[model samples]
Target: MAAEQGKVDPMHQFAIEPLFGSAHWEIAGYNIAFTNSALWMAIATVALWIFVAGGMKRELVPGRWQMAVESFTGFIDDLLEANVGKAGRKYVPYIFSLFMFILFANLLGLIPLPLALAGVHPFTFTSHFTVTGVLAILSFAIVLVVGFWKHKLHFFSLFVPHGTPLVMIPLIFMIELVSFMIRPFSLGLRLFVAMMAGHVLLEVLSSFVIDGLNAGATFGLIVSLPSFLLMIGICALEILVAGIQAYVFALLTSLYINDAENLH
Candidate 1:
């Protein structure tokens, strides 16, 4: 049933609708449901595979896919080298993967059908805060892991300022520690909130436009159309944000790791 009819369960909005489910099918006692996110992920994987495979067997002069992939790879390489130095080269794969996953996910959501699916189920298990939150925390953990792994106990000394008063050492350490702990929280919140709020705003604005048109109020309809258009522009902006947030997460992570490796 359509969401407008109220027959759809709002809480089930996040549930993954599989192509089919059967009594014999299971994965570790968990129902292996096929979700839109998973579908997008699979699509991303296939797209990446095709791009990479094609790039490998390209002509002497690059074709469209080859050039596009090379350009993206080179752009990332340059960004890392410029920002984090030669040492940052090692993290290129991880950063690239993060950026691609996020970029495709955001792009896929822009498709009308996927956007409609989101409205159909708002309270599904998949809609829980955990998925995106976990992704953010995972990224944060990678940064810290790389940092401390490279620096050892010396990494702990990061909290001590280079030229602080002796009396302020403890306070500085406390503040630094608290801030460090909050990194994951902030990272996760930023992505989750952005995704949720952007989707909600788009949905609400669309509803307003429809309502305005139905009411026969010319000004309201006109204004609502612009608002709807603005939402579309914002959706495009969100695509950029997805790529940016991924890059920022990786870059900051590289910075932290660099500091640790250098014992700074």
Candidate 2:
């Protein structure tokens, strides 16, 4: 659909367009062509690398770039230490990369670039459940592997909390096990829904602004003005939400790892 049609189709932003000309690579009957989502993810990865690389310049007096990187490193370090104690330190590299990757991806999607002229647009891969689900599963898999490897069969004890009544052990174990299994779904859904909802709302309000302004002066003043203001507020809120979601994902992952590392 044309950009003009986006005023009607709020979901146009979320469409996954193949980068190549209508050609899809298929293996085992599944299409896996290069897409805008993959492109954006690659862009995010490169951006992150540049950001970290810039901060790698060690100096006698640390510059803003170095300080900024150190600040984030310390923040993640403290978060993991608080959650999983000293053992959590080992997982800092993974957790930090995960947090920064999500943060960069979320923020990159919100950039209002003038790429429309180039037939290019910013895409939020995180808005898709597949992307988020893979991330969640990665974290969950680490927890499972670590738990089973370190604690052996005792990892199952994580499902049974301390001081449970003997009679309620069966019921509590079932409930806890179910909840444990649901973690990946919930983790993925939370980020996906949050990102998608914010973008959809912004698109809808943008459409209203365009339509109202095009209609008449009265409509522009009554509808477009308010919608424009609300859109600005939502844009700001979404930026904040972007960071919060990254933090929440990393924090929860650390906490989950704590269950594995310490069995608490």
Q: Best-fitting candidate, measured by TM-score?
A: 2
What is the per-residue lDDT of model 1 for residues 1-264, given as tens digits with 9 covering 90 to 100? 555663333233344556445434578888666655556667766777776677775578988878888887787787678767888788778767766665555555555645556663222121235755676677677767876787777777888868879999999999988988887777666666666566666666666666677668795668678977887898777667656665665566566556655545
After TM-score superposition, the amount by which residue 49's alpha carbon in candidate 2 deviates from its true location, in angstroms, is 0.4
What is the TM-score of candidate 1? Answer: 0.79
* lDDT tens digits by residue: candidate 2, 1-264: 556553568788999988876346888989888899989999999999999998899886889999999899999999999999999999999999999999999999998747755777899999999999999999999999999999999999998999999999999999999999999999999999999999999989988998998899999999999999999999999999999999999999999999999997
Q: What is residue 2's positional error in candidate 2, in angstroms?
A: 7.1
Pairs of colliding residues, candidate 2 = none
Stretches of model 2 off by over 4 angstroms after superposition: 2-6, 27-29
In order of appearance, the predictions have TM-scores of: 0.79, 0.95
Find the candidate with the highest lDDT and give its number: 2
Off by over 4 Å in 1: 6-19, 22-32, 58-60, 113-129, 217-223
The ten-residue window of minimal lDDT in model 1 covers 120-129
